[model samples]
Target: MSSAYDMIPVLSCENIDKEYVTERTWNGKTKTIFKAVENISLYINEGETLGIVGESGSGKSTIGDILGNLKSQTRGKVFYRGQDVAEMDEESFRKYRKNVQFIFQDPKGSMNPYYSVLEIIGEPLKMLGITDDEEVIERKVLGIMDKVGLSKSVLNKRPDSLSGGQCQRVAIARALVVRPEIIICDEPVSALDVSVQAQILNLLKDLQEEMDIAYLFISHDIGVVNYISNRIVVMNKGHIVEMGRANVVFANPKDEYTRKLVECSFVN
Candidate 1:
């Protein structure tokens, strides 16, 4: 629609497709190809929480992986601040990796069981050679833990000792520790209970406002997406079936596939 580069979105996906090929032995003569994502495209405005919704196989997480540069795409373009991600070199890509971080669905799995909360959060900083003073690292870690509702006491505890919500909070603190410009949340709250989900969502809102960070939130729950997202992107079969404002898309879906997803999520 708009061709002006100045008006370009903070993150835009153009014609993304991802596939995996594996050898199959039906008659020792064929192989199987699984296309996880088909030519999908979408855009996210600056500081906006763009929600990608669909069923489990709809390529939502794959899209996040592609945007975060965690996985290479078979085809497509991902523009971060108007520059194509596919063309980035090691130095440039490392910088891009810092700008775009991810929060996985299971914080327990994402975190190290052997590392303490403080160590887990500080690992990235250490890897980046930021090497701050002990006091400075403690101060920053505690401050971020406070921001995410994690207690300083748990800083010494292992992830296995903490509750699910607390572990997820630690993961959030780790993501925020980097002060990333964009965060790709892959089902960040789906594992928590409804009350905990609300708490996490509130934390995200507060942090987003305070830090001016953009979010690419991926979830299958339309109600949750409706509550947190400014705009919604409906995806199916590796394609962007529809896109619009969250309220409008949920209320008036233009695609049958999108409508079916909404119906299933809200029907109960």
Candidate 2:
């Protein structure tokens, strides 16, 4: 018998296209339509990581936003567990929101400065109707904090008082508090020190194995993406130029853009 990992995809998109309309006054007043992502299709299996890599302004975050349901696609459909996200009822959508969470790159900016560590991490559980009891919430929050390797001493402290790595661990704890099935990690470790980046990456890997969660890991660093992803999707100017297993794509990129990216990774 097939397990959950072998069942339907945890999240997927079909023929996705996203457009941004802008008014430009460079020469004269004119409307410009920019395709941030075009005809992108991919899936993330249960407990698997799918890395999306591209340079800045390559539409990596645009695709992540659509998949996380933080934004809707201009065209095509998004599916969660084979159900159309657009067609879901409010109740279903709420469940989807609880099941799929997003981890933003800027940990400090993503969190409210006023809320303490406990409040920041426990917010999701409260929103998901977990419980109103403070003791229960604290217990669950502490458990997740430990899992993320965060110290309980910082529980009452604010985000401003934490280091970059600590802030990120808090962010991860917040996402994990909901026990989400899939996480859209948008350049999660891009803003940290190299040593801290490795620590966060290892923590994420350990958590994935422990919790059986799936990830759509979005990043611009080819080396970092290759280290963490099972498969890779190479995006270029709003298009998926190349895609394959992580090792295969890194060893032998097919598209010109992908080749350039591989070469640039070495040069950097």
Candidate 3:
């Protein structure tokens, strides 16, 4: 019998690897390669949250970047709706970029400090050729801002002028403006306060429910991952140590690394 993992996912990667050249010998011919992610395979189902958890250097962010097409993997194929992303035509590639939006760990950093919330959120639509009309841009921006719980009054405020929580809400609004099929959230709530984190997480959940958007949620906090994910992927030293239903992995961890993570998260 086939399992949920057998189904073709909204976004999926097979045996992907990412390597970075960290050092070079005096001779240009000799160099040291660092493997940031190794032989990793994962998937995100339609309207589902697939949480990836690992420590700071465990390659979680690298995987996110690769999947979002912000960075390329050194090996393997990434599929969108079962089509190889690398082989896509120009029009198809454009569609992929438009449909796979990203939310970064530092909300304010990802945004242009000089631009107002309206401009920041509306820019993606124009960039993706969705629209260039000012009226349409403003209307869509305001609609998404309202959905993300941002007040209209802050529409003209820049990222520097907003509070951390408000900045994150704007970041989310920007991502949602495109009506993406998937959002790659790379430690999106890590920079906020604990209270703000909960609010942002809840907002993401509500938005996912309403928009039917999938998420590849990457973070170091196992607790946070558990709260938002239907399934979990745990990485260690550039490898996926374990992956399964969130509850099952959290309740009865099978791998040593996974057990350590669960214990650290739940032990008093």
Candidate 4:
């Protein structure tokens, strides 16, 4: 029989807290400690999309950064495949980084202005030492670009030259180039137009099915989150007030905050 340890989520955290200490009035005499995320625990199953929804300053992005390891929590443990991230050796951490990727909200701002689309997409391969051969990198970049529905004609173009939808597609291509096991998507489609948003969402859904990848999708829009996620986590003031299957959470939200969000989503 398999041990209980063998069934842990792909990525998870327990009672994680993130705090920032700053001067109250910039004079250095008075100080204030801000708790961006507090006592939050959550997980992402393999090949599943777990959506986290909250308003601005609700600490949703803070949790995403902590899970992505871009920022560390003040207290608590982060696990990857049931292994503690804090105790990982350099090689193990490198492996963790290779398996976890991020797709940010602003596609144009996330990319370098000078780099071509090919360069932007292939940069991760070089950073992770996946390959040094230009031909191999180009082939992989081209393949991923095609998979994300981008044409090869724009291979040498810069992010500034592309539309919002196209830039987001390039961002998706960059994240998928490494074939990561989990992707942290932080409001990835919120910057695009309504029509374009649906296209990108559909693309993400198709890619998830084809790649068998798990997603930690963080957004403030309940409607968007409900559409993409298999499970939902509702956050308010750095705490998860409710969590369950997507349909169930929306249909019967227990928390007042979650109900307000669901109501707002419907009204909008």
| Candidate 1 off by > 4 Å | 1-5, 24-30
Give each model a TM-score.
0.92, 0.95, 0.96, 0.95
lDDT of 2: 0.93
Candidate 4 per-residue lDDT, tens place, 230-262, comes to 999999998889999999999888899888888
For 108-133, candidate 1 gives per-residue lDDT tens digits of 99988999999998877767656667
Listed per model in order, the count of residue pairs whose N, CA or C atoms clash below 3 Å is 0, 0, 0, 0
Residue clash pairs of candidate 3: none
**Model 2: residues with Cα > 4 Å off, grouped in runs:** 1-6, 24-30
- The local distance difference test score of each candidate is 0.87, 0.93, 0.92, 0.93
lDDT of 2 at 253: 82
Q: lDDT tens string, model 3, 1-268?
A: 4577677788999999999998888886538899999999988988999999999999999999999888999999999989899999999899999899999999988998889899999999999999999999999999999999999999999899999999999988888999999999999999999999999999999999999999999999888999899999999999999999999998899999988877777543
* 63: Cα error in model 1, Å: 0.4
**Where is model 3 more than 4 Å wrong at Cα?**
1-7, 266-268
Candidate 1: C-alpha lDDT:
0.87
